[model samples]
Target: MRFVDEIYRLYKGHFNGDEEDIVAIIVGILEEQSHQDLLKLVAEMDEEELFHMLATYMVEVMKRKVAMDDERPPATLTH
Candidate 1:
């Protein structure tokens, strides 16, 4: 539950919908991936490596968000 809360906090503003729903969505996506390999790699990772991996993933998500925002036209102010 603590881990779920942490993930929810990390992804709060970045995703749409409620925190629980978003967390479930993320978990579902991961479950659909080649998870055996991911599990093996995670088992071999040290704490620092895990931290770096999470940080990198967050950075990539942020970059994608920025790119998507950039594609939208700026809001105009009308007099």
Candidate 2:
């Protein structure tokens, strides 16, 4: 399965409300795997797998501003 598809399968109901969330979820799904393991996994990926990884990380960030309307500001941003 593609990394993107696997992410959807494993985290099917974990909320896909935001593109940024999708990016984070993809990372979360692959989080903490060994670096060598990741390299090995990535090395075997074909163009599509590569897109699954690359496109997943392709998110909209810092567009206009880093904050969202009605979204609570993080503690770091509060004071």
Candidate 3:
């Protein structure tokens, strides 16, 4: 998956973890479509379908962040 590899390479400087673990987490969370399947899907999409998909993803990300925050302690300045 060149797309996945490219993203990993681009952000490796900022991320610290086993590369395999990172890749596993990413591939596990996303729908298991190959790059070619993704290309076909995009090729066949109308603007409305793409927009709706993006909006749904954003909502899911926001919900996950909120849920994660609820599980953590409140932050404090430690200086």
Candidate 4:
């Protein structure tokens, strides 16, 4: 199965009744310019590229979230 299809399958059971597409939520929140284009680019990448991309993107997201949390410490941050 494709990575996205597999993710949908694995999480299908855990999704809330109104929350059908977890991947869409992720993509939707991205800046408007790359919204659909990003997915197209991602689709052409190999597994290794996907892994690194996801890991890097996730870590950056997490770092930003953590930094924004008032209870946490912040450093000069960049994506």
Candidate 5:
């Protein structure tokens, strides 16, 4: 599987019930914008942009989780 696919699979069980759209968006964005140097770009993305992207997707996944009712955890990028 691709890196993004691996991420989706790894977190599939944690999405509660809102993963489909999130996965589609993320994969779409990555496939379109993250070309051959995806890893390097991810590592070098500005803090704001990186976290924004991370938080957006996380919110999508956590839609059914009570813990996210009013809280957003720290963002992260896994290689």
Candidate 6:
């Protein structure tokens, strides 16, 4: 939960929509996992390991977004 809050605080200004909405989306995805699974994963990871995992995930997401942007056609100006 604290990690989710940190994510919201870090990204809220950079992303579209309300901070609460962003937090909700993150938490909602997390809620889809079984509690036992989540606990098992959490128990296996230390704080630093979790941070690195999230950082790696963020980098991958950014790479995909950049690739998508590169594939998009340029906008045309209309008079």
lDDT of each: 0.76, 0.70, 0.75, 0.69, 0.70, 0.79
Compare the candidates by TM-score and give the number of the best one.
Answer: 3
Clashing pairs in 4: none
lDDT (Cα, tens digit) per residue for candidate 6, span 1-79: 4655676787667568777777677777678879996787777778897899799889999999999999999889999
Candidate 2 residue 40 Cα shift, in angstroms, is: 1.7
lDDT of 3 by residue, 2-40 (tens): 555666787767567777867675666356777887777
TM for candidate 3 is 0.54
In angstroms, how far off is 42's CA in candidate 6?
3.2
**Candidate 5 structure, TM-score to reference:** 0.35
lDDT of 4 at 63: 89
Measured against the true structure, the TM-scores of the candidates, in listed sequence, are: 0.48, 0.48, 0.54, 0.42, 0.35, 0.49
RMSD in Å for all candidates: 13.5, 8.0, 12.0, 12.9, 14.3, 13.5
lDDT of 4 by residue, 1-79 (tens): 2545665676677567664465565455444546576677688789998899899989999989877796766678789
Where does model 3 exceed 4 Å of error?
1-32
Model 4 gets an lDDT of 0.69
Q: Which runs of model 2 end up more than 4 angstroms from their true locations?
A: 47-79
Scored against the true structure, residue 13 in model 6 reaches a CA lDDT of 73
Evaluate residue 18 in candidate 4 and report its C-alpha lDDT on the 0 to 100 scale. Answer: 60
Q: Write the number of the candidate with greater lDDT, choosing between 4 and 5.
A: 5
lDDT of 5 by residue, 30-78 (tens): 7776455677767766788789979987987888576675588677889
lDDT of 6 at 8: 71
Error of 2 at 39 (Å): 0.9
Worst 10 residues of 1 by lDDT: 1-10
